[model samples]
Target: MNRTTRLQQITVTLLSAGLLTLSGWGAAASPVQAAAASVAAPACGTGDHGLLQDLQKAHSGADSIPLSFSDVEFLNTNIGRAAGNGFLIGTSDGGCHFQKIYEGQWSFQQIDFPDNVHGWALAAVKDGQAKYLLRTADGGSTWTRLSNQAVTFERVEFLDSSQGFGYNRASTYYTKDGGESWSLIKTPANTRGAAFTSRSNGWAVVIVPGSGYRVMKTTDGGAAWKQVLKSSTSDPIYGQISANDSQVYALLYGDSGMSQTSYSLYGSSNSGGSWTRVIAQETAGGGPAPGSGAAVAKKGPASGTPGNMVLIGKTTAFLAGYQPAAEEVGVGLTKNNGRTWSNQKAVPGFEGVISFTDHNRGWLAARDLNSSTLYVTKDAGATWTARFSFETAGR
Candidate 1:
């Protein structure tokens, strides 16, 4: 059997063995239809700074702050997908700090990492250019600068501490001995995003410059690749690609008009050869509501287009977003792969990113004028409780 097929079999076996549980918020309750009232901010004492506050403080007097706290990446270990075990690379004026959260509490220790380091993949600056790959085996406490390469990497993915892949502006690269060395993987230009199920099976989304996007799959690591799906003029495709062991999901977006922004969710069971449109909706841009004075646009899905998504299984997934029409943040649940969707209760505040540990438990990062907080949901997004609140630091 091929590596992809074997990996799928192993995943099925693990799930059957109860090694993995597929539970998340709203796994049992009905779909929510209305927005949940905004809750009061939790009382936090001194020394309870949030990730954003730290970033703001770090670049307080700088001419420009290129990084936003909302854009900071949080790495969730696969062993405990969302049970409060995660890592965040904190940045501030001083330097970088590795923050680890265990059981809902955060412990931080500063490290000698560079600023603007995003996600688990690290990069080093040489003469104002990011030129080398770096890895940290001991969480984010320390990093070993890998041998320098002639590529300016923009994104990197590590399946484990040692093995991983990275891509520059127009090329793909891989490394097996951590980031110490890397070899180029020939692929089409304009490749933007990639995900690998194993060393030999993976997929990437390549944009055709002024045209649209296409999905590419690799079976022998990144050494070889083939185009599996291409966007046509009739149905233009544009969005990011995310995958698991057996399936790949794409959150596509299209601009119809100021009053007709389109969003769609597509899934592929056989890599990227074909896709099924699981959910489709059109966002009514800022305009008169239906039956008002102007032309009434199509109503958006009950659940707004989520900026992020977390797939629990082949058929189960959760999407959450802050709806401008309703002026609230809400979540939607789909058990049959987007054929049908149920809107969960909306919560007040802008939901930045959503992560789930299982099918029944997850966490959300929310931001408001006064503070940024992390909310935890135990009932699969049916309800939420504020777990941590960080006061926005003053300018």
Candidate 2:
């Protein structure tokens, strides 16, 4: 998602979830005040062993300032997950430019067709509201416009350099020869999010009108899809899915005001053919009393809400979120697939979005003083180092 659209979604979600109070057209709480109360001290782990000191000694400090994408509204979705080789892509200035992070170094370059770039996918595919599609083969060094006619896509994903898919409310499009050619695929339902494990294996969360959310699977590329699971309640369930070689994991959240404001984690080893509830934890204001037949007790404040979740391995994952009532931001991890969780030490900032490329390397996007900063961690969720700061970059 583009930074602007993602921020708008966050504002709307926060308002709906009662995390932010709105008086007229303004927020009652300032970003700085909220951030001041939310930051948590780092929880350095056993292997930490002066990793921060080592980083300082090796790089002399984190990457220098004047970083790309530091001027515009920043969102956690701005940074893409790290590829197998540790190639990471991020947007700057709302997708007008690109930021490449490789080998612990950061570099920036402008997109060839910079107008209205709303979303991007791996293997360098860029699309936007203007119906334009562009691709870059040699990283961001050069870009090629791929579409002659107009097309609108809200999300795009590429499993590899040769295959990709893009979609919106109206239609789904796919390409095999990189982004050079495109074709249409019939969608099972209106999809909110989509991810592919391979060229022919993928999953999508479909909004089934008044029914609820349905997890769909596709094995013949995009030619067909089958419903793997349908929510049992009328309450809306928003889901984010991640997949590895043999299993698919879904982190789900119900409606904001439901009596039981709990979140669920489900895993399927057979490509969404069947699912097992891995973890279900009640939120602060909803569900049964702790240890009174509940599987997992609430850990954060009474009004804490769930945020982004990433599965780095079959049995390991991380979740980031905050408790608006207490102005506390927290991160948690589940080593045994979510059956049990341990809250990491607080890190003193509103955790917005988190992305993990592997078991121990990840990045977090946080908001403070109405600006965004990026933090990187090489030791799981232990110690984090500030990699990019908007304020410092601007100076």
Candidate 3:
């Protein structure tokens, strides 16, 4: 009775039963791209096995095989979904074209899509120490492997299709039935990231072995949590957490020494109860630290912040970073939720992962280490365009 009032009574019962509309793509065509090109092939048979096989090969001529996507989700602007390395691609029309809805050898890292046809992934299993949890209703074609026990959760958040929340650094998992079953809550000792707006409301970013970061919260859900926010000392702070309904964001960074590295972004429109730093620390550099003999600090302007953030509504938010000496990519926008911040228009690559499905569509995944590229923006990040690319060892 408080998931935003049951999602505003399920969007007023889907606009009084008309099923709530508003979808476009020029000429008459696009029922979610004709139901995603009518199931873009997802039935790989080889005695299938766990992790939902399918997608044996063919990502484009020449055996396309170099992917490094860690995450990407666009339930709009022409269906979209992406996962890392081992594959789990999809696209109807928006990002040029993408296929292969599932594959394995292990590697999903993170993915969550609370709605638009349920989704959730976290796999890792490739001798990577095990971790699994994959699910997809109809949007990503096919995927099913709820849990075989090893749960590490690099990060995942959902608030629909039956609640969700998972974090890393050892534990923190919860599912309210949509994940088939999962529950190991009671987090706090180093939980790397977490974000939730309902299912009782939540937030996390702990890491205090010697005292460095904290930003816990919960409201009758994760059993119990408190520590509003911390980290004014202890030097090793690093953080992450993002939310939209009831707002809630946290970034945090550390190491502000001669080599720089001080970021901070905090906001909370109630879900977290109280918080407001927006963006403060703002520093960035990584050119000297191999020896501790720092020197070569003559860059005088263009500091940095926005390590990465996404919250396309609830006042709007979008932040990205990667300005290694202005090579490109450095946006840091905010509509009002963060008081003020503006400097859009600077896309290129290497922002890793970012997503937005509102305030004018968005997507970015510029991984590196061989290949991984995909960018798009309608006018929100000011500008950007580069649909797809994933090549390695075939180049």
Q: lDDT: which candidate is best? A: 3
Q: Please give the RMSD to the true structure for each candidate, in Å.
A: 12.9, 16.0, 19.7
Residues 60-101 of candidate 1 have per-residue lDDT tens digits of 564522222232222221111111111343211111112222
Backbone clashes, each candidate:
20, 5, 1
My TM-score estimates for the predictions, one after another, are 0.59, 0.57, 0.29
Q: Higher-lDDT candidate among 2 and 3?
A: 3
Against the true structure, candidate 1 reaches a TM-score of 0.59
lDDT of 2 by residue, 1-395 (tens): 11111222111112222222211111233566445424432332222223223332443335432222211222333223222111233332222222332323222112211112232322222222244454654333333456666456654555445566665544667777866777876556667666665567777777665566678888897788888876544554456676766567665565444333566656665557666665556644555211122344355312346665666546776777665444445566766655666666545454355656556666666554433455667676677765544332223
Residue 153, candidate 1: alpha-carbon lDDT: 67
What lDDT is obtained when candidate 1 is compared to the true structure? 0.48
Q: Indicate the residue-level lDDT of 217 in model 1.
A: 86
TM-score ranking of the models? 1, 2, 3
Q: Which 10-residue window in model 1 sums to the lowest lDDT? A: 1-10
